[model samples]
Target: CRIQRGPYRCHEKTAGFNFNYTDDPNYGPFLVSVNGVAGNNTELTFWELLVQTGGNGTIIRPDVGIGCYIPEPNDRIILKFTEFVSGSHSVSGNSSNPGNLTAGNTSRLDSIELVVVNNISNTTNKTYSTDIAFRGVLIGAMRRLQTNSGFNFTYTDDPNYGPFLVSVNGVAGNNTEKTFWELLVQTGGNGTTIRPDVGIGCYIPKQNDRIILNFTKFTTNSASGSCTNPGVLLFLVGLFFCFLI
Candidate 1:
């Protein structure tokens, strides 16, 4: 959202060339969008390949998506927006709003157990099996819990970390103060407790994951993990530039 990726509309000097596209309300930017007239059954284009023409004029489409594609010097980027049409391939454009990300048929993962521990002693202050949502991230679960239930918590977006869990039950943490909240997961039906190998955005809960938002403090280099993966982090990261809501 801070124009760290590309086409930063903000007042920032050009570090390199970047492209601009609309942040449509219906579908995301990676899903192609059209402004003017379109056919009735037009669909959102799925960005196929991110062609990087090197100095030697060689093309490459990375195994990952455009959101996670890293750029190097002397690289030419070509974005191919394409879609399938009646057993044929065609250019991508705005056909209609993006399809339902999570269809209505999914009703299995309804709730999850959330254990809130304050400080190092790990005293369980609040515990409940809140409803699990299709938010696609841990932050979304917090937001949904706040609305569906009465769970109270606050967080800030770190340029490095996706969602900096600052305070829970009225406690806040900051970088300079060497204090921050950490996330821990209890696996195997809540028997074993271990820190997640990855950040919250990348880790999707597998039904019975006991999400523990622990309040802790860190020293000069302790709070090191901040998220950069754009696939799931885009929705929250873009808020720093301009939140849709």
Candidate 2:
């Protein structure tokens, strides 16, 4: 609602943008067009909702839409006009609505376990339950843990890669030592583990997901080590940005 309301409040006072929207009773407000460019289904085009995080120019497409998204201070909202291939799904105008975000098949569990592990020193190892919103981003849950569970963390926002986990608690990663925190997750009935391609800013934690922050290093020429190849890591990160756009 702020996206729709802010312009009217400040249009006469400062430099701003204009937008058009429709108020759906069930989903609230949804963006129809921005700055006069509209999306047409016949043309396979739609308005894509994205945000550039405050202080950094790293852009990310949120899981929620205008109705539920609360922009933080200094956040630059982006309404990109995009076209998608037929038979392929995209995060279009309708897909970002509240109905698609919180409708049927959404997970029931609202809490996830976060395990912090220091593989190098093995000194600091603890777990906390991060209470999360339905389909909320991981960073929100992490902030909640820092506020309520005595957890502390810091990240470096990469212009190209979004937020990179720099440290957890008081432990910081060193570039010279080639050590950094790796994100992993365990899900499903048999506890299948996986390393998420996207970083904290874009990754949404699932119900009962066991998130593991393993402090480790990239091995030199080792095929079996975690994050064995830096090139592969970059490739995955590229895929993440491509999918979001």
Worst 10 residues of 1 by lDDT: 89-98
* Residue 43, candidate 2: alpha-carbon lDDT: 70
User: How far out, in Å, is residue 11 in model 2?
Assistant: 24
lDDT of 2 by residue, 1-245 (tens): 23221121122322457777764432334667777787675675666677899977898876555544445667887777776543344323234333344444344438799999886996757999877756666776787789877789987543333345667888876756767677778884569998764556556777789888888875433212122123333443433221110
The local distance difference test score of model 2 is: 0.58
TM-score for candidate 2, residues paired by index: 0.54
Clashes found in each candidate (C-alpha, N, C closer than 3 A): 5, 0
Q: Model 2: runs farther than 4 Å from truth? A: 1-33, 36-100, 103-109, 220-245
TM-score of each: 0.55, 0.54
Q: Rate the local accuracy (lDDT) of all candidates.
A: 0.46, 0.58
Q: After superposition, how far is residue 171 of candidate 2 from its true place, in Å?
A: 1.0
107 in model 2: Cα distance from truth in Å?
A: 12
Best by lDDT: 2
